[model samples]
Target: MSQTLRVLGTSVTLLESIRQRAEAELGIRLQYQVHDTQTAQRIAVMHPERYDLYDQWFHNLDFVWPARAIQPIDTRRIALWDEINDLPKLGRLHPDDRLAHGSLPCDRLFVQPDGRLGSRPGTQISMLPLTHNADSFAYRPEHLPAALAGREESWSWLVDESWCGHIALQNDAAIGALDAALALQASGLARFDNLGNLRLEEIDQLANCLIDKQRHGHFAGFWSDDREASALMLGPRVHIQSLWSPTLMQLHRAGVKYRLAVPKEGYRAWFGGLSLSRCVQGPIKDAAYAYLNWWLAGWPGAVMARQGIYIANPLRTRDHLSRAEWDYWYDGRPATEQLPGSDGLPLIDPGEVREGGAYAQRMGHIGVWNAVMDEHNYLVRRWGDLLRTAR
Candidate 1:
C-alpha cells in the first residue's frame, strides 16, 4: 500500500493539477492540509507528526527551523539541483536582484553540519524552492472617483478615507502588517526604519492606524483565504484590497473588471517552497523527495506559470510551456493567442497584456518581502486583538 504523504501549506500550493499529477505519476497518495499562513506555521512547528511535508513561504523558517520541526533536504536528491536558482550563485544580477529585502537571506538557506541553517555552500537546504511572485493590491475602476480613475497607482488608496467602508485587507498578520506599513508610509501616516522586519513600535503605530480605520468603518472585511477574498470582491463589493495573483486570475476568469495596481511605492514580493517534516523517514521520506523532484521537473512549474507565479528554475519550465504562454507570462508580451489558465482551459483572450509588465520589470520593483519580524510574537498578539476588536 502507498503511504500517504500529508502536505501542509497555504491554499496557493494546493493546486489540483499538482495533487492529481503527483498521485497519478509519482504513485504517492497525497493528503493536503490547507491553512492560513499563521495557523499553518503553528501546526508545522508544534505538530510535525500530522504532516510529511510543509510548503510555505520562506518567512516560515524563522519559526519552523528553531523548533526543529523540519529537516534539511539533500540537494543531491533533487533532480534539478544544479538548475535551481541560488541567490549566492547569481553574481551578475544587481544586489537588490540577488537579495530582495523581504525574502530569505542567502546566508540562512543552506544547512550546516551542525544541523542549523547557514549561508555556506552545502548539499542540504532548508526548503526546496518552489514558486515566487510579486504582490500588490487590485481595484475596480468603476468604484473610483473620476479624479482618481486614471491617477498613478498608490498604496495610500487602501487606507484612503474616500474609500472608507469599501476596502478590505488580508487577514494574515505578517503580510497584512507589510501592506499596512506600505500604505502608512505612502500616506505619510507613519514611517518604519525597516518595513520588512518591523520593530515593535512600528508595529504598534501601524496597527493603531489600521484599528482606527477599522473603527471608522474603513474596511469592508478581512479575508483569510483566496475564496473569501474573491467573495468579498463579488459580494460585499470591496473596491480595493491586498490581492494575490491567483485571486486576480480567478476574478478575471469570472469576468470581474479589475486592475492590479503597480503601486508607486513598489510591490510586496514573496517566495515559497517545499520542506520535509522532521518526522518523515524511510519510504515516506523517499516519496517526499520524489514529490520535490517532480515540482522542479517543469510541468508543475508550467501550471503555476498560468497563475502568474514563476518557478525557481525558469529555464526548465520552458520545456513544458507553449511559446505564447511563456511570452505572455514571463516576457510581458501581449498574448498572441488565447491562453489557458492553470486548469488548462482558455482564459486570456488574444492581445491581453499582463499586469506590471514582464518578469524582470515586476521583480525589479520589490520593496519588501513577506516576512516574520523579530517582534513576531508581539505582532501576532496585537494582530489578534485587532481582529477581535476592530469593527
Candidate 2:
C-alpha cells in the first residue's frame, strides 16, 4: 500500500540508478528483481503480480508477450495522462521506427530510459522503447582507402573485400557475430531478415574467420564498451573496430581519425523497451510516470542521443546536440582531431548523414537481441573453435 514499486530488470547498474533517483526525487523506492533474458521471461510467467514493472525490448519481441499477459493501458485516461507537461525532447529517430512511438509518451506509459529516452512508446501509451543496439561501421580515417573518399553516396564500401583486414569485429560469435552475417547479407552471400537470422553453419564460418584475423593481430583489439572502443581508436595503432557507434563518436572528437559508416550492405540494429506488470496500481504508478517524464525532457534527452542510441520522441530538440555530437551522428565526420598528415583536424561535417534516417529506421536489427544473448556462449565457443582449426 505504501509507494514502493518492484521493477523486474536486466542490468543491476541501471536498476540501481533508478532506485536512487526514485528515492531522491519522488520519495519512492523501487525494489528490482534482476533477470537476464531467459530468466526475465520466466519471471513474467511465474510471478505475474510480483513485478510492478518490467524492462523489455521495444521491438515487440519476447519481452512484449508480457504485455499480452498484462493489462493494456486504456487511453480513456488521456487527461490524467496529460497532467505531465514538459516536452521538447530529442528524437530524430530512424523514419522506419516511427510507428513504435505514434501514441505513447511519459504521459501515460510507465517507462524510462537508462540512456534517458531510447526508442518509442507504444500506440496505446502503455510501453516504451528504451534502447537501440544499432550497427554502423567504426573505422579509422588513416585506414580508409583514399579512393573511397568523396563517394559517400551509399554504403557499399564495408563489404567490398578490399576493406577486409582493417576491420575489427565483435568477438562473440553467435550474438555479436552479426556483421559477418550482414556481410553475407550485403554481398548477397546469404539473406535472411532485414532483421535477419543466421544458421549455425554461417555463424561458424564467421567465427573461424574472426579467430584467424584475431590471432594474426588484424585488429586494434576487442571492444567491450563503446567508450573503450573510442579509447582504442584514440590510443595506439588500431584503426578500426566494428562495435557500437558510441565509441566511434568519441574517437571522432578526440582527433582519433575514424568513421562510423552505414554500409551499402546495410547495418544491423537491436533495441529494447519497457512494460509495466498488470497488478501494478495507484500511487507507485504516479511516481513511475514522474520519473519517466523528467527523463524524456531537456538535458537528459540530449545526453541519450549524444551517446549514440536512437530516440523516438520528436519533442526532444535537434538543437540540444553539442557541435561535436551533431557532427558525429548527424553528419559524417572524420575520427581524428587532425588530418592524418596534418597538424590539426578541421571541423568536417557532411550533409546526408545529418538528415540521416535514425538507425532504428534504417538498419535491420537482431529481433529481441537479448533473446539471442543467451546463445552467445554456444556461438562464441563454436566460433572460437573454428578460428583455431580452420581460419
Q: Could you say which candidate leads in TM-score?
A: 1
lDDT of 2 by residue, 233-296 (tens): 6665555556664454455456565556655544455444456566766876665565555444
Residues 1-391, model 1: lDDT tens digits: 3778999998887987789888998988999998887689889999999999999977788888999999989998887888876532341125556355554545467888998877788888898877888899998888886757667999988888878888888888888878888998998999888888888888899888888778877888888888888989887558899999889888989999988999988888877889899999999999999999989989899999998898888878999889999999999999999999998888899999998998778877877888888888898888877787655
The residue pairs in collision within model 1 are 102-369
- Name the 10 consecutive residues with the lowest summed lDDT in model 1: 86-95
Candidate 2: deviation at residue 85, Å? 18
TM-score of each: 0.95, 0.57
